[model samples]
Target: MMDVEVIENSNKCARCNYCRVCPIYTVEGWESASPRGKLYTIKSLVNGEIDVDARVVKELFKCTTCGSCEVICQVEIPLINLWENFRAHLNSKGYILPVHKKLREKTFREWNPYGESREKRADWFKDLKNLTSTNSDLLYFAGCTASYRTLSIARDTVELFNKTGLDFNYAGVDEYCCGSPFLRTGQRDLAQKLFLKNYKKWKEMGIRRIVTSCAGCYRTIAKDYPKIAEKLDYDFDFEVLHTVQILDEIVDEIDFEDVDVKATYHDPCHLGRHMGVYEEPRRVIEKMGIELIEMEKNRENAFCCGAGGGVKSQFKELALAIGELRVKEALNTNADYLISCCPFCKLHISQSLNNFDKNINVLDIVEVVIRTLNK
Candidate 1:
């Protein structure tokens, strides 16, 4: 039998071209790249009008899962979930992309998609003593990207937590990947295992509030985990928060020295459209006394940085092309820095800026706060 959700969501597409404003569609310029076009493809495949092929796989997986198309869908179809369900369906039939398969393998082996050693996961802040006690109720989940690739964001977040006298526990070496990559790439079984592991660990540790610096991690934990928990018949009771949410709540309590820089914020797809966390990060930037400029596309309508949904891993050229467009928009603001809440976004956007030979600093919001505090 065909996947009912895929067929239903695809049939719901009005084809009014609203989802044509998508970032991938902008770069690829093919109807197949547009969300509308993909929906048609999905319906045709599910109805047996078309067979599963490489072109079909590419067109489907090319999406960034940014939720922009979902925002524009007139019929209010849940596009993100549909995409994941279809991808999961495809994976079960052995249509998984090679890189995405490797990603799953790495995550299973190292507990992170980056293939970094699990023992070294907490090396970034293991020496920062007295700030993170395992006995604390608040857990700081400095996700895989922040812990492994963007070490400074993790350090800065820990510093901010310490400065604010916020007692939190770091899962340290025991922290597994929150399973964002697995879910996005259609490894549902792997994602469920990760959810169970993390959820049970938190429950056993008496964790009440979970905080993360990466937007992907925040979205996965705060939004995706609960759904998986319900499916698995587990009770999820933890309060998940992004670092900006916590920082926003404590902003007035800190002494922030003015940092003289004009910066524009890029809304990470996971944080902005997926989770409706548009203003908190912006409000925090404003609290630092830095001039925050608006991009041509900002908040709900913001273009993706092209790092999500396993696009960056599988379609490198396509991902960079999309990233270049967003970086150009950041350059148009002529700000001294481009600020974003996600380390993954910073990594991709910075790469795009370099490829275009443009000079502009990319910093996470926590990095900005730490800079102001020291100055």
Candidate 2:
């Protein structure tokens, strides 16, 4: 018995185009870019209707894999999984994009998608209290983006834990890629290798729980990790959580001072649609006593930051183009700041904010905690 949701929906697709929800399609507007078109193309390929080519690979990889298409899909397709499955399928047929090929090599070689030195992974902690060990029950898995790219979020997250009297540990440089970048890009073989390595590390250290400020990390380790682990004949028993989920637990204990800006929250597609973590970040924001305005799309209906699915790395311009739309939605709220729980979202949307000449600040929930931590 196969998982029907996983196996049959692609063929069940009614070609209704109800899944016009694709972000890439929203920007590219090509029939090949839309989910409906992808399904047709995919169906044809499976039935020997067409030949695989560089062009098809390019269109298939155009997606952000945001799961929006999955939400509105008329046939209840497990669209995210479908896209990824097809991506892996494409890879099997030697359709690997150069960018994806480079990313896979860089991640495997450098232990991160950034191609940054593994030693510098802990550089963010040099200025702060760096906690790295498995002695503590909680391990802060900063993921590559937060640990290297968005250093402030990593620092501020530790600061928030301090302010709220939450005790945890950080993996620092010992942290490897969560394999999200590879997984999203259809490099499941590499993803599985990294996943097994990290799981073995946590198991050896007796880590009881893991928390992360990166939504991609949260989804990968919390949800995808266990799934992949079972495939590896390995079991990862540690509890996984997002920093916001931990903050939500200690939210009332921590004090917050309101700043001058009205803030709107952006839900990371991985955290919101991928994992269904809609309210914890919201609750953390509301508890700050700041004026929280809703974005045009919020919760389950939230738009993708265009940074997921390896889009930011491969299609930089397109990623920014899609991100600009989300930034526009945030700006329309007249909010001075755009807040999100995921560092990847922070990195992408923050770039868009600057690109649009909008003076709006992009903040992670941890930074907000640092601001109001009885200072």
Quickly count the clashes in candidate 2.
0
RMSD of candidate 2 to the truth, in angstroms, is 2.2
User: Which window of ten consecutive residues has the lowest lDDT sum in model 2?
Assistant: 1-10
lDDT of 2 at 112: 92
Per-residue lDDT tens digits for candidate 2, residues 252-329, read 877566565588999999999999999887888778877889998988889899999988888999999999999999
Given candidate 1, what's the lDDT at residue 39?
89
The TM-score leader among the candidates is: 1
Q: Score each candidate by Cα lDDT.
A: 0.89, 0.83
RMSD of 1: 1.3
The deviation in Å at residue 36 for candidate 1 is 1.1
Q: Candidate 1's error at 221, in angstroms?
A: 0.8
* Per-residue lDDT over 169-262 for candidate 1, one digit per residue giving the tens place of the 0 to 100 score: 8788889999998898889899898888888788878899999999999999999999998997888889999999998999988788857899
lDDT of 1 at 307: 86
| Worst-scoring 10-residue span by lDDT in model 1 | 126-135
